[model samples]
Target: MYIATYIIDIAALIYLMGLLYSNAALNTSRKKPFLIAIILTIVIILSEAGTVLTNNGSLNLRGINIVCNVLGFILTPMIPIAITLIFSRMILTTHKLLLISTFINIVATALSPIFGFIFYVDANNQYIRGDYFFVFIIVYIINLLILVIITLEVGKTNNYPIIGKLVGLSIFTIIGTSIQIVYPFTYSSWHCVTLSLLLYFF
Candidate 1:
């Protein structure tokens, strides 16, 4: 399971890099969010790798899991913000809804340390899933709603290509969010990898 997860993570990292390059080539102002997404992806990949290495006894990297915890709590939520930015450029209109969504993303990320409890390792280094896991589900739903709104807004205004990209992104967000929700049970990393591919292709 770890090997599969790691392979998917590596693919996701490559996809994020590609997205960065593509956005740069198009001179899109959305590059900042994409760059941020890239950072988030890197952090996730490293965190997973660090966990696996430490577990396998290949490297005694202390505090690595803590880093993973921090990144997952803080950085993962920025994905919606990144999508908002990307769609903003393609749609060419700054709606109040987008602003609100961005604010929500920021707030959620900031409050992650306090509110995040989906899956955390306790002081004894034992994995303890939080009781407030449903909170993350609600958050994911909101994020998905935002993506849907963005897709609709983009489609209502933009040309076919941009609308198509938005549609694709929306699908990716849905799939990725679903994967994340089931991650604990299934332990699959394909969610992030597929999300990165969507980001790259879109």
Candidate 2:
């Protein structure tokens, strides 16, 4: 199942990248955020693959695992946030806020190895819950809620064609994050995001 999901995710990211690359016809308003999502998706795939590939039982490989895990933890939440911003009324002007949010996670992840506050890899190279595990869910949930609210607000004009699909993204992200929070071993969050993007474009 892991291998299948990994392959699906990488394939989805590659397809999305290609779709967006030559998409000169993408809605001009949403095109920038869409491109940003593609870039972040690539970052996420690399980080996810790194975590999967480097988890041998050796202490030397632990560094790679830790680094990859930290990168994953940081990139994981950004996916939904980026997707939400793409569907919402957000633009480049509001990116500083996203940067601040990402910076907070980056700091917590950087501190996790020492303090185990954000996330930590066990001696077995497994993800051990940290003090701030719920923090990821909270951030994701808040972003999802904000995305939903914006979708509804845009719906007020009766011109928001993608409201339902955006809401689906919200629901999928919420469920995926919830499952991942309860069962850290499942790797559900990234998969959910990939599925959501597929729905968004298709």
TM, every model:
0.68, 0.83
Off by over 4 Å in 2: 89-102, 122-126
Candidate 2: residue 40 lDDT (0-100): 77
Task: State the lDDT at 27 in candidate 2.
Answer: 79
Clashing pairs in 2: none
lDDT for every model? 0.57, 0.71
Residue 28, candidate 1: C-alpha displacement in angstroms: 3.5
Task: Give the range of the ten consecutive residues with the poorest summed lDDT in model 2.
Answer: 90-99
For model 2, what is the error of residue 17's alpha carbon versus the real structure, in angstroms, after optimal superposition? 1.7
- Backbone-clash count (model 1): 0
Residue pairs clashing, model 1: none
67-177 per-residue lDDT for model 1 (tens digits): 565556445555665566655653235544544543454455444445545555544444454665565556656666776676677668765556766666667666755
